[model samples]
Target: MPNTPPSPRRRGTARTDALLQVTLELAAEVGYAGLSIEAIARRAEVGKHTIYRRWPSKAALLMDALHRVWTTDLDHRDTGDVHHDLREQFVRSAAALSEPPIGPVYRAVIAEAQSDPALRAALDERFLHTVEQRTLDRIALGQRTGELRADMDLTFATEILCGGLYYRHLLTTRPVDETAIDNLLDMFMRAYATDPPPPDRG
Candidate 1:
């Protein structure tokens, strides 16, 4: 019996996903700065023109790849308690980062972005912007619910908490464990919780 070929749309999606997956694996192994179109094409078993046809530059391809992997239907439901919700979401994020390829790939992308302006812009526009807006909205919701201090600078507070995660991921080998998450929340509550007394030191 003869086999049927995939439709154009299905074939395109499959190819694109394959390329992105290879890109991420290479990024993890060698860092973004060390990856090249030739390498990606070879690894993906496609010609250079195949990649160049879709993305004009490696940065553009990576931008799309990062968004594809990291910005899909993330869990952001309100749990009625801001601290519980934030901790749950953050722990999930930490766990995702700990997964093979993702952790090193993300860190490599971020590290490369520091020295590459175009990549940095792409990272901010494609990935960071979406996450930051969601975070700000969540913080605003927490304030409205009186869980967070009304006067807290939402952006700055978000930066401190989120920045700490990135810092630990990129700079420190410390595991993003329950203890680490609790410690971060402890600092956050001390600084931003609206309760008169500080949140329990636990």
Candidate 2:
């Protein structure tokens, strides 16, 4: 049987993936400060216009590349134990934020966002908002299931949970290690668990 040639759509998708992969490689090698569309084009063996047609700027290209490499779902799982689910998700995220490709690319985008209002807004809309909402959904599930205090302010709770990790990951030299994750979860459970911990027996 004769083989069929790939459709233009398939070819286009393959090209897009190849471009994104090259973007990630360059971003990792040069860091965001040194990464540029021209560099990407040169490395990918494509015209600069090809990349610009797909992505308006370096920030947008890097963001897509980061998403491609960081494929872990940002949503928390329904393990019936919200704490466990949150911890599981956070551990995964913390590792990504601490490690290569995703970590460095993400950090670069974030650093650039600090000075680019449009990039900041895109970052919030595409990444931060999705993470925050997924987290809040998990917490809301806990409340509905009677695992968490219904009266707790979920917005603030979500911020504390997500913000603390990012703060340590981005702002401080401290690693978002197991100890930090456990402490954060402990504090959150203490503040929001429906059943308070037993009185100290020590």
Residue 30 in candidate 2, Cα distance off native in Å: 1.2
lDDT of 1 by residue, 1-202 (tens): 5788988999889888889988877777777778898999999999999899988888778777766776563565687777888788788778877786566677777778788898888888777777777767887888877778989999888877666766666678877887888899899988888867434332
- Give TM-scores for every candidate, taking all chains together and pairing residue i with residue i: 0.74, 0.78
True-vs-predicted CA distance for residue 1, candidate 2, Å: 17
What root-mean-square deviation over C-alphas does model 1 reach?
Answer: 5.4
In model 1, the Cα lDDT at residue 13 comes to 92
Looking at candidate 2, the ten consecutive residues that score lowest on lDDT are 193-202
Q: How much is 8 displaced in model 1, in angstroms?
A: 8.6
* Candidate 2 Cα outliers beyond 4 Å, as residue runs: 1-14, 45-47, 73-75, 196-202
Candidate 1 residue pairs in clash (backbone atoms < 3 Å): none
- Model 2 CA lDDT for position 13: 86
